[model samples]
Target: MVDHVYDPPERCVAGSVGPPGQRTFFVQATDGARRTTVSLEKEQVRLLGTSLVQLIDEVAPREGSEEAAAAYLDNAPLDAPFDDDFRVQRLSIAWQPERERVVIEAYDRPDIEDLMGLDPEGDYPWDGLPPQSLAIVLDAPRARAFASRCTASLEGGRPGCPFCGQPLDPSGHICPRANGYRR
Candidate 1:
């Protein structure tokens, strides 16, 4: 497995492209010379942001954390002219107490059918090809900033239906609460 480790990336953030209801989400990590970008589901971005904020609050509760986050807030769009290294299969985050950092890992996906068809007693799955991954570590303040950007990006998307909580497309969606009515 190739692990692109950015021990303390110069910048890391979540961003999206395209319009709401058809947007493609991505997470990017960059040092100076190398930048790694990976595409992921919108839900993954949401959960990561939520988890980052929750984890930071749990470990580094301090006055002015929000204010401190502003200092590191990166509202800049993702670096352009870049191709995604891979599509994220799984995302995991954790706190590093000793170093006082948050570690985020995005694992590249393997074929679902191959994974499901694995033979426990046969040769290991993935055969000769190992998936690549991206790992990023950030300080608490930067993590908070990253989380804020995530929340902002999500809120800019399509408005949610009051009754069903599903995103309302540009043409409206069939809300379950509305009994099949497109609203």
Candidate 2:
């Protein structure tokens, strides 16, 4: 139940530091003074970015607020020594009218105790570290820009196989859409 909240974070984006075929996905949020970067599934990044844009467009209370959002948060290189709170297992999005921003919550997967229904250790707390979550808030324009950046990041990776729309590594691709033929 512990959450790291970044209200109107200075920056929030989905980016990768490795090559396309061997890249690791990440979602990073910073508040100028503090920065938090977390690992996430590539699909998760894609969905979050796209969903934020859609939600803001559909539900923002103010008219033309989407266009007024300031995409000022620049994606600097992720700080080194990625911490424990960096891995994200679940992501949720919502519009906060009071803040005039879209809030994105990234949560860790359920712990063994929660999944197994019993804590054999008898000392493990369900609200332990690995199960924590990070929440970031961004305005409509920033959310839109973030979605575009995330989508661009995904596209920057390996080229997709024309046959199946699956990513193609630099060396080659075995496209199942082509019936297991290398495309």
Candidate 3:
């Protein structure tokens, strides 16, 4: 369940802790008085950011229209440090037309054990841990900025192979498109 909900985030940005591809991705939300940072998968970061841009483009606003939410974030350092309790496993995004905001929810990934496709709920003792979640709301401007930042961050990593479009490591990449030939 989501315990924290920032209805209107003063700052909401997707950032990383270390170098590209080697760093952990995080989305930080701040409401002036409180702040929270949640870790996420790199793929999730890319998809979420891309989707946000698409959403904003679909509802393109005029130069001085009132539909825009004007919640622009500076993409500064996160107010709160990353914590284990905020590890995100699942993400949900939605558009609030009335408020002209984009709502994003990050949920902690659940743990489950399966024995040969059998459920382990009754066989094992409970761990007494619950999945925590955070929900952040962003305006159009802020959402656009965040999406751009995320896309740029993802692109800053190692270049991809032209043959297979797979990321090439420092050594090189063996592209399957060329029958396992190094590209």
Arranged by lDDT with the best first, the candidates are 1, 2, 3
- lDDT by candidate, in order shown: 0.84, 0.72, 0.72
Cα lDDT tens digits, model 3, 1-183, are 578888777777777777655878878877877878888888999999878877777774542122333345354765555663567767778888888788888877543332346564544332466657898887777677778767755666768888888888877879999999887
**Which candidate do you rate higher for TM-score, 1 or 3?**
1
lDDT, candidate 1, 73-168, per-residue tens: 898999985479888887889888899988988887654565785665667434466778888888888989989988876767888999999888
What C-alpha lDDT does candidate 2 achieve relative to the native structure? 0.72
Q: What is the lDDT of residue 5 in candidate 2?
A: 82
**What clash pairs does model 2 have?**
38-86, 39-86
Better of 1 and 2 by lDDT: 1
lDDT of 2 by residue, 27-130 (tens): 77778778777888788888987787678778763542544544354556656655535577667888877877787888776444455856556664344644
RMSD of 2: 4.0
Best by TM-score: 1
What TM value does model 1 have? 0.86
Note each model's CA RMSD in angstroms. 3.6, 4.0, 4.3
lDDT of 2 at 55: 88
